[model samples]
Target: MESEDITIKPADKGGGVVILDTKDCVEENLRLLGDTSTYQMLEKDPTLQFMERMRGLLEYGKERGIINEREFKYVRFPRVPVFYHLPKIHKKLQKPPGRPIISGIGSLTANLSEYVEHYLQGLVVCLKSYLKDSIQILNQLSDFKWEEDMFLVTADVTSLYTVIEHLQGCEAIQYSWQCTLF
Candidate 1:
């Protein structure tokens, strides 16, 4: 497969791999990455800039008593994030789509992401629609009374992370944080 100029990805629905021409994969990925409203081209690496901004934010939080000195020190430095995607072979489009994944596992903001996730975990699980896993969906569905005229539908939000307005998302986090405090 490597010698033939192809790309391989795990299937979106089934437990197998989907292989496609490399050119087609590149084109599909580029189409998603080319959206100016969600993404922009950077001439230079933004790693330093990102680190500086994170330090400033952490320092401000420390000063405001929102974050402790130790926490600020530990969360200051962030490594670069890796971006990749999985092919959505289940979709019946002319060209198969890709689901963009920005893995923050070892990135500069990884620690911050983990912190926020930990803070929100309890509250999130308590919500009405929260499901620990896809299998849990069956438990919820079982409680529902099925009607002949009604239909069960599921929807997937495309490029959900990229399309979210930064300020609005931050405001939402802030709101959720405040609600948890009281």
Candidate 2:
């Protein structure tokens, strides 16, 4: 791909390199959520609506001395619309039939720093698995005398947290964790 094609114009100074377009990212996220059964649960849970109603009811109940101020102030509930994209697999056909498929998943979490560290750790594990698979494929291909050029490309989102919209970032994290939790 050309430089312009690959380049992602950052929304802010600290944001990392983003090769995939925003729309593509959103689509990929949706696909991941759908594939992993996260989307279904989200659809079933009206979290935002429930929160709004709860807040109103709590406030009203507090006026009637039914609930305390502490309860109202620190009503900790999972926020809706957590933004996290599913892993993206990019397949490059170096040679027609035997191309290797490489995938990278990115998450924009509420706690960016923590998420970055977590993403890095996950990436390491993924890379190890991918490397092992590639080696096996290469060994098998060599034994069969199948001469085909192949390359595996691994990519990462350099700094995701600082750049994404706060709402979207939260959504991404929620979606990502939902998959794991479920």
Candidate 3:
């Protein structure tokens, strides 16, 4: 397949997720949140619902003493994300599916997320440690002890951000803090 007509997605198991026909309809697919039918759902709220939600979250934070006046001042509204896709390098006869990344850069949510990350840094297992660079991982891997007849296996999960159940993951995090021994 031609480069414009094809892309790659990580396999749920071990192979590549190839799209059979890309033809000339890439723009619709690039918007990973949803297709044309979904875009129809985007409508201006006359009641200022989005602002209300933000206000509620901020109020809740203030009540819980989680956010100070200084932090409230620091928050800035985030921009709507821009979407783009990078095609896969290998394989033919299929177009790779692209997923949308909700880039929270320069947004209030991003600031809040970063602030929360500071607290999570002190947790039993830091998410950042698991997401370290390849060099660090390779250096650590050098210390792995192999058994006499051992074989190494590796796998990548597809669409992890979209696939994970967020609420369940939060519960697991709570469980890690409560039941698991560090």
Identify the leading candidate in terms of lDDT: 1
How big is the RMSD of model 2? 14.7
Sequence-dependent TM-score of model 1:
0.79
Against the true structure, candidate 3 has what lDDT? Answer: 0.58
Model 3 per-residue lDDT tens digits across residues 62-135: 88998887876666666654444443424332444444445667654677678767766567455434645679
Where does the lowest 10-residue lDDT sum fall in candidate 1?
Answer: 86-95
Give each model a TM-score. 0.79, 0.27, 0.63
Q: Candidate 2 overall Cα lDDT vs. reference?
A: 0.47
Q: lDDT by residue for model 2 over 109-138, one digit each (tens)?
A: 223334356655554444423445668867
Tens-digit lDDT string for candidate 1 (60-83): 999999999778766746667776
Tell me the spans in candidate 2 whose CA falls farther than 4 Å from its real position: 1-16, 41-49, 52-67, 76-82, 86-182
Off by over 4 Å in 3: 1-48, 90-99, 124-131, 179-182
- Residue 30 of model 3, lDDT score: 49
Worst 10 residues of 2 by lDDT: 93-102
Residue 122, candidate 1: Cα error in Å is 1.4
